[model samples]
Target chain A: MSSNSKDKDNRRRRRSSSLMYQEPPESLEQQSDQAVLPNLNAQWVNAKGAWLIHIIIILLLKIVYDIVPSVTQETSWTLVNITYMFGSYLMFHWVRGIPFEFNAGAYDNLNMWEQIDNEDQYTPAKKFLLAVPICLFLVSTHYTHYDLAYFMINFLATLAVVVPKLPALHRMRLAFLNPEPQPTDQ
Target chain B: MNSSNIGTELPPTAVAFIESAAASFQKIPGSAIVIRYIRSSYQNDPIRSLVELFLFIFAVRYLLAPAYSTKKTKNVHLTEDEIDELVEDWTPEPLAGEQSEWEKLENDRIPVIIGPAAPKTKLQNGRTVTNLASYNHYNFASNPELTAKAVNTVRTYGVGPCSPPGFYGTQDVHMKSEADIAAHLGMPACIIYAQSFSTISSVIPAFSKRGDIIVADKAVNYPIRKGLQISRSTVRWYDHNDMEDLERVLAKVVKEGQGKPLTRRFIVTEGLFENTGDVVNLPKLVELKFKYKFRLILDETWSYGTMGRTGKGVTEHQHVDPNNVDMIIGGLAGCMSSGGGFCASTEEIVEHQRLSAAAYTFSAALPALLATTASETVTILQEEPSIIQNLRENIRAMRAQLDPRSDWVICTSSPENPVMLLVLKEQVVKDRGFSRQEQEFLLQDCVDECLANGVLITRLKSMPPALGSSPRDQEKEWLPRPALKVCVTTGLSKKETEKAGIVIRHAITAVMKGKKWQR
Candidate 1:
């Protein structure tokens, strides 16, 4: 009985050791340590850079607005506004890491890798990036009786980016806005 | 485009045919009073109403396109090479099965489903047959004494609350349940909803308006999307689980609304992804919410009764402050083994929703038995910690047994949650291509096999991609990544777990062997 017990113990030890030596299962902890942290640093840099560009573009637009005192012309003013809106939207995407392909059907692919690798770490960032195309599409096309295909494409693009991000943002906002009170004696 | 021509072009025979067809259609099959009422209201202006009706139908069809077109099937007429290529692209074997003594031992296992009813037996010809599908009244984990106390309260209180909360519907039991949930969640107040489905569909749009922006997860439940559609709120979707995408959307919304008036901005998420079984990072999500200044709403339907040390849900599991969440919605259907939904929030928010939310104001209040049962379940969950431990053990055992062979079988994991995804063998997929009808058949077949081996399972279909009005051919077909979602309730036992594992293994192995079952 002693010998059998010793043999079982040895087998268990051997199994555990073998498992330790083998590669660990792919997990969020390990993946976040590698991909999410490093990617976050890159994203932060991009965000700062994009913010800088946004400031510069706003300054340039201010200059244009200042020089064009006759800004009441509907056509030219609309053109200027469009350019500014497009630039601001692009800057948002640059910071947020919006995928180039904005089709709603393919939106799942946009954050597929992040969700698989490190869901918690990447979910918020993906949610933020989804807003760029949607805001642009909505503001740009609100007045137009465009082709059905054009309207549908924009609608799809907006939904693709908006739907996924809304949930994450919702949770984040809820947390920030409604901080639990620290217990204190009156 | 002529006004007369638009209503014209109907021959006398065609008109007669239409009249006859409409009459027969009303008599045939099943027709609801609501449908007949709506149809009769539009009968006066037939031509104009017909066009409007067709348009409305088209819009409804488009909105629900994802649910409609998700079923794809393999063409039987395809050439061998084409079939081979299609199979190779769409479905591939994730793991190879091993034939061993252990496998053989597992093949004979049987599982039983337990519930509130008595065990049933059947007679086959002249012989007595023992029924294995007896899972009614399997509340071994539930304290009978506690259940009795709750039932006594319910019996004394009567059956249902009957009216919406806005009316004279708020009973003492309902108030107590709400208070209990709020205290457990550590939130200021709680609001009860008839169902979690209505809670999301109603409350979300109530908080925001047309000009307001809503950013949500693409994989949110369908009812939420339907609510957003009716609200006409400009929605921006971020990639699932991508925090960067969320920040970008926030910045864009803020930036774009600089000159224009921006209304309320809201963000929504699920506590634990019901489909993938993935946990959301509550702390990080909170941080983003603070930075963005958008109201956050989390649906903790799947997580409330299963996650955390105390089963308060992801907020507790992640060690985040529950009070940090603006609104926390959860359903008491699965884990509580009862029915009803509760939203934990501030008193002001609860009051506002009770007053403004249409569903909350209109829907019938929860039945008394369910409220009593759920409240009792909560008390049991809080007092008896070992139930969670046993569930965890069952989850761990199942994972350890299944993960090694995940390649041969398709299994998706989400930490220690009771839910797990079981992917069927590639041969099953080859036999049943991506068609919705075929997928349903495959699911039914799998359930049958499991039942034959004495295991019961709840089957679910995946949320399809949103598609708008388009011709059938033009509409993008979303294929469900076929999986069997396994959920372990408090009623499951160690013996039941082992038996279920064996039964599941046998069902999977039998299917892999290409053994056909009668439909």
Candidate 2:
């Protein structure tokens, strides 16, 4: 087979695998009403990538502390982690994504996408605040010159996870909700 | 080695990166084989090993994100074209992700008849006092105690709560009604809504929301469907009264959400279905609830005052403990013969509804007089338990002697249920030579004929469209065939009950032959 055809086959396999959970609309409706295109899209497309990064970062730090005795500056890493958590929690939950509880039930007590819309007001401020704590930690700890090894290992690992999810995170469409469809390629 | 079917190869740099990553991932000590060897390694240093296991999981999820087997379901996100097709030719796709927006039920188009007489079926249809077609089974419209309470409340507080519940609209009588209903249901707390229409509609949304899972009966009422829509929760509708189907769905959902503790799951159903006048099997439901750890919400709007030994509803009637069910929502309109709705549950749940429920917060409170009447009705239910007993006996009398032939009229619901439904035979409906609308009109006309013959009966009125009903018998209609609902009241004597059965039987037969039986 031609290399080009093989590449197309590979792409087809990727699409089908990523979408293994999908059924025809009628079957999906029969199975679970909330398990529609919009939610599925929101789940994969707009998933909180920041949260994924945080977990990976924390795991790497813990490995450093456990395996190599983590040279020093423990307090700085802890504080930096704390701020990342706060910023991501607020932004993801309030604006970019929906928590399970808010989206999982028969009737929504929460107003329709009101919180998602309201997310715009203070997110930039919260993001800015997040940077301050990280900057302070770096300033206090003499951030560079310690170890490229740990950073390299964790960064490479996280990129593997984050790269594939990026498309979905950007393009997630909440199926039932009537938001205008946007082109995902951008 | 097997490069013959190779896809377009990546650039050399990308290939080199992939090779190096594979080598590095293999070299990382706990990252590769730790998961497979975890059980054996756990005994070496359980706590440290546990920590290692978690870290390993994190690393693997990150490393294999592309290959991660996520358990999300495939959904048919309709293309714009599919939406257009559905819009033009709306079909019976009950569980279709999007319920057709343009399809209208008979009740949506037809107006309800307003009855005037108390305890008697004297309906006011424009000019003359016609037979009251539907509602308030016992005609408590003229009960002395209820009337006195209404009169006193009107004299004191006037007609309505003009403002919403959060405003100055909450009356003392509303409190009493909530308390009375809570006590009657043997629940810790209760919250009353303005009217029956919004009762289930508001209550279901109060607890459930998007991302949650709700497994309800397919034949649930319209209000429940509306509530489901608002919550945007994942919902699965099991077939009506089919416990096995409910179990299959619950088991599958529990399996799918195996590790997801935060994703709430509930089993929602009606005690006596509004569409079919059938009772749900509560004992079996409680058993399934226990097995699947699903919170149960029983909407007993039709069964509240009519069922049970002392009128404690499905729990009393079915001999199941009430505490097993998490929430109970019902209307006061049934045997109580009042206007309004109440939800009874744990104190915490009721409190949440008070703070979170949109209908309660945003809508006017129940009228003070109506609340007083509801409270009085509860008191009467308890004090004169005979009210429920008499109703049951009347039901028994109606069910016993009224052995309707399959060809004539068949009682579809349980005999113990005070709400008796007499429906046209399926074969007959299919065989009939009329158009779908004409068939509906003829069935409705039979109800009118029954009313003219001194028995106040009504056709199955439209409810808020639930995953509502059955496929049409004759046409491409997506609704249950029209049935005559003869609500047997406690006030009916044995003779009256017999007369009702006779009248209904005669009506259906004569209506089929295209003849009208006069009073």
Compute DockQ for each candidate against the true complex.
Answer: 0.01, 0.10
Question: Where does candidate 2 chain B have its weakest 10-residue lDDT segment?
Answer: B62-71
Q: Which number leads on DockQ?
A: 2
Model 2 lDDT tens row, B1-519? 234467776777887898898888878987665444544445444554454445445444444434222235488899999999889997665554643432344334333446554335434444332233445555476577678878999999899979888889988888888999899888898999887878888877777765578998987877777887666567887888899999999998888776444567888899988778789999999999999999999999888887787777889988888888999988887668788788899989988888678888888888888888888888887888776777777677777644454365677778667777766666665665555556667767676566666556667765533344445422332355566776776555767776666677776777777643221
Give stretches of model 2 more than 4 Å off: A1-186, B1-115, B119-132, B259-262, B397-407, B430-438, B451-454, B463-478, B515-519
How many Å off is the CA of B391 in candidate 2? 2.3
Docking class of 1: incorrect
Q: Identify the runs in model 1 with alpha carbons over 4 angstroms from their true place.
A: A1-186, B1-143, B424-440, B462-480, B515-519
**Candidate 1 lDDT, tens digit per residue, B168-270?**
8878878888988888888999988878667777777667654467888765666667666645456888767678888888888788667443468888888
Task: State what share of the real interface contacts each candidate retains.
Answer: 0.00, 0.15
TM-score for each candidate, following the candidate numbering: 0.53, 0.64
Candidate 1 retains true contacts at a fraction of: 0.00
Q: Give the Cα lDDT of each candidate.
A: 0.59, 0.63
Error in Å for residue B501 of model 2: 3.7
